[model samples]
Target: MVNFRKYISGITVLASGFFLAQSTVSTVLYTPAYENQKSTLNLPSPITSMVEKAILSPKELVDINVNTMMSDPVLKNATWGFVVYDPKTKKVISSYNENTPLVPASTTKLLTTETALSLLGENYRWMTQLEYSGSIDENGVLNGNLYIVGSGDPSLGTNKAGAWSYKEIVSDFVSGISREGIKKVNGDIIIQTALFKGNISRLPENVVWLENNNYYLPAGTTQEINPANEKLIVKKGNSFSAEKKYFYVSPYMNQMVYADKYDGDGILTTKLPDAPAYLANSFKTTLVKSGVSVTGKVTPRMTDGTPESRKMISAYKSPTLADIVYYTNQHSDNSLAEALLKTVGFQKLGDQTSESGRSVVTEHLKDISFDLNGLSYVDGSGLSRSNLVTPISQVKYLTSLMNEKYYKTYLTSLPIGGQSGTLKRMFLGTGNGQIFAKTGTLSRVKTLAGYMKTNSGKTLVFSLLVNNYSGSVDMVKKRMEKILEPALDL
Candidate 1:
């Protein structure tokens, strides 16, 4: 009461200080210029449009891009097909030319692999038996031919995808022969190739034979091998070509079927005249390296006709059929794929020819209720020009895979984007591991089929096939990537 004026002045100063501190804190917290003004807190139109596009529905995006893809000048005379489906809902989200039949190329491996996985359980193994028809004496000498009867095993000496190695093969066979009390062979080693009935022709693109006695590369690839070291130095070339081709070989390498020739894009490949003989030679060399002495030559024959009294000495079992299929599909391995196809025919139709394999595949597709109005299968590896199928049929087959008991194994066999297999260089920097697919390429045809994971956690299956394109194939791939880009956004 004595100093009312002074008391009022002190209270006003305290209130002003408090208000200033509160204003400073608000300014520090609100960074955007628009945030300072309550009425303009909304984003600008450009930023808002980007946000909307990022969240666009899968169907909406497909619809928008399909039209653009169809109108591109690169596809002037091309027959193209595209389909996207939802497995959970069993519905087609988008499609364009989905019913048109197109050459599938290596994508044919998909059908071959799927059929094999369904018929042959995951743990099924291919067997190569080694036995002798005659007896060994007390001095450890055998008087009969050692026979190798294969059930079309493509993994005998291969390490690319199989679990068995050359060392294991040598050890196992040596042990088996030792267990039979045989220290020396007095007869020739014969590789019987008629067990499967049909003969397989060598693919037109194989060029290199590895030191381990396995053919490691297929057609459509080129590598520069160092002549001095017999090692690979460069591995770059077209996967498919019509006008130009090139391949390389190391001069110091062993186990080669023939000498290297040609240096340009016109390299020609010769058929494997005698596969059984080649394998026999490789095995003979391995036996010699393991301190086994033989006084006989390695030979190939059509039939063993071994008497029923022949004793089974040893057998080499391949890895599980599932693992083999995984490697086949992942690398687009033509040899393995064709072998599996023939195996399927042998199992189902009692015939091992490509035509018979095609029949088996046709029957399988029908059993699965796939619409095969224009589908065709001429060979298991799709190296033949006779294979054809529609995008719609492929989509249906892929969707049906989800309901199968071995669906997980089947899916894992496909090439993961930017992660593994043939798709390692594809979809880089944009969906990378999010896409798992199988790629197919011919001179003028390109195709991609597989499963994709969306940004929203939804899974989509798609098949995009393009054939008879007029421009460069690389250009077509770029356009296809653009068309599929929206799926990543979804």
Candidate 2:
């Protein structure tokens, strides 16, 4: 017989060692599995789905979200052109019908502004010079015509913020003339508008006119006058006054004409005729009021070329191009947008017609290697329904500017979602501050294009163009917000 106590001790030690090894294996495997199971059980379906989405790549997430948005029954009859791109990676994240051209509305301003920023630069300033072709005599008399030389400065006499008001501009001109000690002018006040050569009042072939009462007329209709019953009323100012008034007129009329009783209800919104002539008259009136006598009448000369012998008294510099661009994007100012287009044309192609501007912009797009296969660029402002553009092309154009020196200037000029500009009242949700974009709207079209900052600190360029959508535009906008809001957290 062996010693029973020694045998028991050896068995006990073996059992203890086996138990320890089992514990180590359980901690290494079973504990984590149990914890993971418990955590997964505690998460709801929505939370689990969110977690799954969080792990997906940006492209994957964008694709899923956009696919879902496009599949909605409400959008069954709508036409869409959308694209999201990553400039840093030079990759397209998601796209749906992006190559199809659609009416871009005010988003066309983006093209105009981008071209202006690229060619003219941010510091560019338009100059409106106060010049005289004749000499000033010792008797404080000017022997020549006082010319208001316009460089197609759109904001020349406007009262936009950061710009001189009409009153202030007139005052400055008067002061400039008084400083020269010219008490009397022997010649007429001539308005030189030869800077823009083509039809100054030209409209796109597909331009749509919207009356003040929200009536949409046929394309290419400049006015909505009842020719059989109403007569055109013409108003002429007799004296120089600091107050400037805007009058609506038909495209054919060069002078300010009122419709019927001039209740301010007419087609072709914000259409002001003979702006240069109006400015010239304003100068004449102000000069006379400031004790400078003019012997000749105010004349508007639309022909080209200024006299080489003309001397510049003072040049009124406009706010920087960046400032003008900021205002243009913020307000979606059609006049300002058109001015920028013509300006780029004048500076780049030496021609200020709308056609020349379109050419310059198209060439710029080509220089940047942007495919223009489906582009039908008609006007700088989206006032023309004929201005067609593909969403992909817009996104590509926007992405190309990311590496540019003026990128910051261009980006900041856009309206910030839920904060300022046209988007001030929109995107109050997750998109607030995350979106800096331009908003475009027309009868049946709604578009948005710009930069979006994702939750992961990535910047994306995107364009969403919708045409011929059924239902209210606000509903479409809400759907658009829903689609964009998800990308914010991606």
Candidate 3:
């Protein structure tokens, strides 16, 4: 419930941080010179008096706008949950069905990311190690299997911002091997993915899978496969040095895989059933091209324990958790969000399964005293329609973070209105630069939750969740914009 402030003469400043002017008419409509000109306009006295008598508080105006939108034909049957809260006064400014749980869409990333940052810290990094099981002889000829150990790093070999490209990663590994005086005879390239012990398929059941799109498969799934009808094609040219030879093959049974002629960056688009195996194959190819012979093929090994004799040769560290969180929130990256959720489970609960991650997030929320009534957290990314949260709960969770140590990191990671990420084209007029929030969208669902700076220089946290609307997504967005536009003056 809101505490309404009484209106006074001249100017009234409410404790709720809104300024009101007690005037016959709005300043925009009635200037000082309008007193003399009012008679010339020949307006009816009753109409002029009615215009002068109409004065509404900010809260009342927002309520009117929300009620009007709720009654609109397009949204007559929609379930809406909205809340605007002030941390300073510890008050709810405006709310509509705030306690009703609704599908949150991508806004679930907010929970996944915030939980990760709280548990993993800002500077935490994921490490992928290059190691060998056998020993190299004095002649640098005898060797054992080379192991590419993974710690469930999602950014490995990705083109994510601030992440190393696959080419660079391979080059570093090759250089490190060469520096160690290892010239030849690697038995095989083994990708070790035992860190996440069981069941690596992280996608929720409700997420839709598209054909010919890139997907992150289980840790040890095989990425490269040759179609029976397609033969490996090798073309020799004058520029092809002994150190570089191109082998083009159909990496996926459904799609062809080829290396960049100039850089050897294998451009892969199909779902990588086994990312580590693909990387291991890449390492084998590069090793052979660099004059190091591999006697065996690439393999993926999933064991609970690594041999004590294995020696680490090199390591690649991912960008810090902060960078990953920023990218996840700004872009609403589903894969990264899932990875972070699994990592949180692995780090805190010793299991990397989705259930474990969900439990971890639920426990974290409980620890923070957030109300769990009518809340259903199914997956890290809200791609699953099973995810549900009330608008009041979201606003409460957001308000609780104001005093946290990582609040700055969390706040800056959200998309800025009309400036960056998903919100770049939104809030282009008055809401521009005043909203720092996350946007969520799914079929018949749209959500927004974050902080807003009002025209009166007051900061407010808000959440607006809508479900089952009978209109285009763009139409819903326009209505949402209208509702938020009035809040800009609060």
Candidate 4:
């Protein structure tokens, strides 16, 4: 949770630091009222100080430069600057165009995920029930159709043990009938996936495919992907797996096979693929079974519906919201985020449709007083540049989350600074593990906003927004990420 007091303390630090540099730091631009306040407060970082302090409230986040550091030589060639805020005094540290609204990209997930967690709570789970719309005789034969209802649970079959709800659903049905002294169904197996209503063939064309594929599978199913494959796919010669940690599906696995010996939970000894999409198009890959190999085509389960309805036989629980939150933060799992968003909205709107979830969230943000003028949040994944938000709005909403009715549990869902979750390995080995923040990226936009430790050992709230750069988008964002190393290094 963000501290409200830090905001005020930052102002105090900036007020006194302004005059320390006095005549030498006179080049900084200032607002009329803000300048008056600076003079009245008569405070500034002096040249003799060991640390160069800069704070960007709203106006400077959009235009921070390397010059803010007064030391980085590379910043002269850099695209945008930074917003440095002193924690002890809540004031504008040094800033450049902090007020501009830039494209937020995945950073927008921070908004959507936080909103969902705050309003919905972390204990919330998805419900995928096994229902039958057919008549079952005492002999154990189902005369009609077995309806497979979808509760839009993304975590279904995503157990740490590895399985899917569709498979789980069938497994449950088999067990229920076996428990009932029955062996098989006399009628057809009818699956009713009438859960979400929308187009199913081609997904709505968008920039966030990697992010939104979870919740709304093309609004309709076309390609059948392994439910949990979006994350890590451990295969022979795949690069996604490290010594102990397995990363997301990288681009190098389309043409590799695994040795039978790799599955014992040791390590990926083969070379990793350089790219992640190598496996996306290979719908006809073979998997090894019991040290042997088997090939199969990807199949989509039937979701057609019939008039008959039957009671649920067997079902399984999806992953808890706690794990989902961790995924959302660590990998910036947009798909999971979207799935959770729609599930909550579906609960309120009577269905798991994306449109309904979008509506519910938008309304809720409004209820909490989020600024909607520049924010065009469409999907929860932030895959769309169509979605927008200002730094001030981000901080304001974050403050609200801290005050939520279930703040303690909700806070745990968020990743810890350098300690765990997404921030892990970020500030690692830098002794900056105390810093906790979320990283969001997209072309032309990047953001690092959350909590950070300040010079005085007091907690500080920080939001860094970098937009409108002219370099390779990824490289440009890398520069944005590097800003935090120094900001939190103190």
- Poorest stretch of ten by lDDT in candidate 4: 213-222
Candidates ranked, most accurate by TM-score first:
3, 2, 1, 4
Per-model CA lDDT versus the true structure: 0.69, 0.71, 0.73, 0.49
**lDDT order of candidates, best first?**
3, 2, 1, 4
Q: What is the lDDT of residue 184 in candidate 1?
A: 79
Q: For residues 1-490, could you state the per-residue lDDT of candidate 1 as single tens digits?
A: 0223443344345445555655343322213353335432122133333433554454565565666555566664689999888888888878888888888878888999999988888888888788787778888888878887777776666674766765677578778877887777888887765644445454345433221111234433223432112222333463323332223332322212222223334343422323344456666777777666778887767664644356788888888899998999887877678788888888887777766777888899889998888788877776555689999889888988888999899899999887898778777766778888888877677889989988888888999999888665556666677667777755
- Give me the runs in candidate 3 sitting further than 4 Å from their true place: 1-54, 200-271, 304-306
**lDDT top scorer:** 3
Tens-digit lDDT track of model 3 for 1-490: 3323332221132211232233344223423354345242112143322332356557765665576566675577999888888889888889999999899988999999999999999999988889877778897874787878899987877767598877788899999888778888658777778655554443332343211122222111223344212223332331332232222223332211222223222222223434566677778889899998889888777773646478888999999999999999998777688889889999888887888999999999999998899899998877677899999999889999999999999999999998988788788876999999998987778889999999999999999998999766756676777678768778
**Model 4, runs deviating above 4 Å:** 1-96, 133-138, 159-169, 199-309, 416-421, 429-431, 453-457, 470-490
Q: State the lDDT at 134 in candidate 3.
A: 74
Question: Which is better, 1 or 3, measured by lDDT?
Answer: 3
Q: How well does candidate 2 score on lDDT at residue 350?
A: 81
Candidate 3 residue-wise lDDT at 316: 95
Query: Which residue pairs come into collision in candidate 1?
Result: 205-219, 245-265
